[model samples]
Target: MRRFHIALAVADLQDSIADYSRRLGVEPTAVVPRKYALFRTDQLNFSINQMPERAGQLRHLGFEDDAASGFSSTHDVNGIEWELFSPADQDAKIPEVYGKEVIRAG
Candidate 1:
């Protein structure tokens, strides 16, 4: 299976989480307090990161593929970054990017 992925920088993580949860009709799958949140649905893998300076901007675009062997990323001609990875790849990287202690399963 492959799911479209979207990552955005938001001014407020909590507010964004609430708003997105309502919009998506589901709560996030995982959240890192004051930092980030990730929501997964049948067709999408959406995430928001607390980034006031970059709020309202797209951080990147990607795909979550079950058959993917590892995580990889590249920039498009327009300089937009695109990533590809499996769920396990993301899980391994999350703790490295965001401290393990801060992540809370949702």
Candidate 2:
């Protein structure tokens, strides 16, 4: 399973929520006033952040991987920050992927 993910900074959270809700034809999956919103459609998942410090900027860009091979980056790049929901198994080196026993380095 795969989904397209995108995130953008919004000047007005309420207005953006309404606009996206209407455009996407659905309400946000989660909404925190003056903070952020998550909109999910059939093929796209996007988040809108109410960024007063950096309005009209990209908040992040990336997709959530169910397999979570631990390749996703979770840091800032050129002032843009990205996030991913990693499985708890992420820290564990998946043996199936490595073809051998993997140990975590201290």
Candidate 3:
């Protein structure tokens, strides 16, 4: 399966998580306190980061693909970053990327 992934920067992590949970109709899969959150659904792999100055901005886009070889990222002609990774690949990178331990939410 391949799920479209979206990442955004938000002003508040907790607030965004609550709102997005309602919007997505499911709680986040993992969270890093006031830093980050990940929400995975059948068709969407969504996440948000607490970056006040970059609030409401798209951080990047990606795909959560089961058949993906490994985590990889590149930029498009417009300079928008895109990633291709499996769930396990993402799980392994979470701590390294966020520099904090994550707590599974649901």
Candidate 4:
């Protein structure tokens, strides 16, 4: 299966991590110094990275699915549309897989 992680750039690593932990109700699995932090869920892997100018900005989005499965759909954020997928073809919609309320910025 193809698996990937989405990394976001933030200004305050600790603050962001804490906020996300509370919001997502899960602590990060790994924390790297001034570099990145990793949070792995059952279906998705969320990461935070420290960047100078683009802090608190959306870095990139990713998906994890079997190579054989076709791309399901895409999410439009700002003016860009991000392709989405699932670990299995029979799985629910993309928004259901990754919380629908989660905002994706451009």
Worst 10 residues of 3 by lDDT: 97-106
Model 4: per-residue Cα lDDT over 27-56, one tens digit each: 876565555566766766677876768886
TM-score of each: 0.95, 0.64, 0.96, 0.54
Residues 1-106, candidate 3, lDDT per residue (tens digit)?
9999999999999999989999999999989888999999999999999999999999999899999988999999999999999999998889988877789864
Tens digits of per-residue lDDT, candidate 2, 29-65, equal 6565567677767777687878877878776776655
How much is the lDDT of residue 40 in candidate 2?
63
Candidate 4 regions with alpha-carbon error over 4 angstroms: 1-4, 65-106
Root-mean-square deviation of every model:
1.2, 11.7, 1.0, 10.9
Candidates in order have lDDT scores of: 0.92, 0.65, 0.94, 0.62
Give the runs in model 1 whose Cα sits over 4 Å from its true position: 102-106
RMSD of 1: 1.2
TM-score rank, highest first? 3, 1, 2, 4
lDDT, candidate 1, 1-106, per-residue tens: 9999999999999999989999999988878888989999999999999999999999999999999998999999999999999998987888789887555555
Task: State the weakest 10-residue window (summed lDDT) of model 1.
Answer: 97-106
Which candidate has the top score in lDDT?
3
Candidate 2 regions exceeding 4 Å error are 69-71, 74-106
Point out where model 3 deviates above 4 Å.
none
Q: Decide which is better by TM-score, 3 or 4.
A: 3
